[model samples]
Target: MMTTALSPEHSGDETPKVKDYSPTSYITHSNFEFCGYSLKIARTLSASLGVSAYVWEAGIALCRYFEKEKISFAGKKVIELGSGTGIVGILAALLGGNVTITDKPTILEQIKNNVSTNIPPACRHRLKVRPLTWGQDHTNFPTDYDFILGSDIVYSLVSQPSLIETLRHLSNQGATIYLSSEFRTGNGSLPFHEVLLPDYFNCQVVDRLMGKDITVYKMTKISTDPADGL
Candidate 1:
């Protein structure tokens, strides 16, 4: 949300100069209720911060899915990828999951702040915010996660391969992965699940929000047989 503030110079030539603006000046907060708790989330309107700074509809859809389905993450090792605003992961922690909320290095600070705003001091130990850049940082995390969550993360075809690789790296055979995305034309999100994912994981549509163009997919790693094609 970087806006250019132009101030006219007093010189003979009427020229405008740029005024510096603080990034925090563009931040706004929103409150959402989940698990009987009111969570306040801060979002930066700066486009430079990228789409991760705003809360997408898909994220809220996933949150509702969690409540409607009564999916239990209690005592589970959970991680959320591309956790913009950390809403989904925060809700999971409130529901009793030991959760890790992650995004790229530049966005980690925002997620950390959101985690602090929502999670109470005593229960804050259940949540952690860390930097993770898809394929590059996948190795730093363990592969034994019980649940992996993502929302609105599959908009880029260019990043699909790395995203899939990271998902594979973080999940074991027993792990379940939930991803919610808005279906946009030429976004590669639907194809990521229908085409790209079947090779490494078994995926199915677990929920869809009518009229919202958002879908929630539940996936699990497919155990391979070395001799299957031999």
Candidate 2:
């Protein structure tokens, strides 16, 4: 049934199925179960694509959060940013949200493959994939998306401005942004909380034991309007 510990049996012993043409390739498959639904995800290993080719812990945590919150995606319009391995978006699709899962143009095929493999044909109509480079023109994308989902996307300082801008551009007033990032010890981690976040969205640090390193934040767009009576 449902188990946090992964078993080799869960990874299906079938011969590695070819999904693409990468000169040298390595692949792994895993299963995740939540709310009585199971999803099979395949990951392709690539030196160039780096971590974008695999599912990260933050993604798993977000899935767990969705299950815990009893989030029903039925009829909801959702967008997932940097949807590596497409785990979270697939989970959303299974829950019934009409979801757009996006990443760099180079990464879209892998995500598409994942979506094709895991999501059933009936539920597949609800999922879409697109190339989205944050902080750029997203005029073609929906601005009134009911929910924006991101996981482990706050790792870079260079991208923070565009990230925030993209967030503002995608979210309509009062829409919630759910972002999960691990609390890294060094590098640009602290800036997200200490520096960059204060300048953009109003953030609430979720106080649950998501291990010591991982923290999930619920963010809402901060008003830019001058005070009526503040």
Cα lDDT listed for each candidate: 0.81, 0.77
Candidate 2 structure quality by residue, lDDT tens digits, 82-134: 99788888888889899999998888888898899888898888999999999
How well does candidate 2 match the true structure in TM-score terms?
Answer: 0.86
* Root-mean-square deviation of Cα positions for candidate 2 versus the true structure, in angstroms: 3.6
lDDT of 1 at 116: 85
| lDDT over C-alpha atoms for residue 48 of model 1 | 57
Off by over 4 Å in 2: 1-23, 207-210, 226-230
Q: Candidate 2's error at 199, in angstroms?
A: 2.7
Best prediction by TM-score? 1
- For all predicted structures, in order, the TM-scores are 0.86, 0.86
Report per-prediction Cα RMSD to one decimal. 9.4, 3.6
**Candidate achieving the largest lDDT:** 1
Candidate 1 is scored at a TM of: 0.86
Cα displacement (angstroms), candidate 2, residue 16, comes to 10
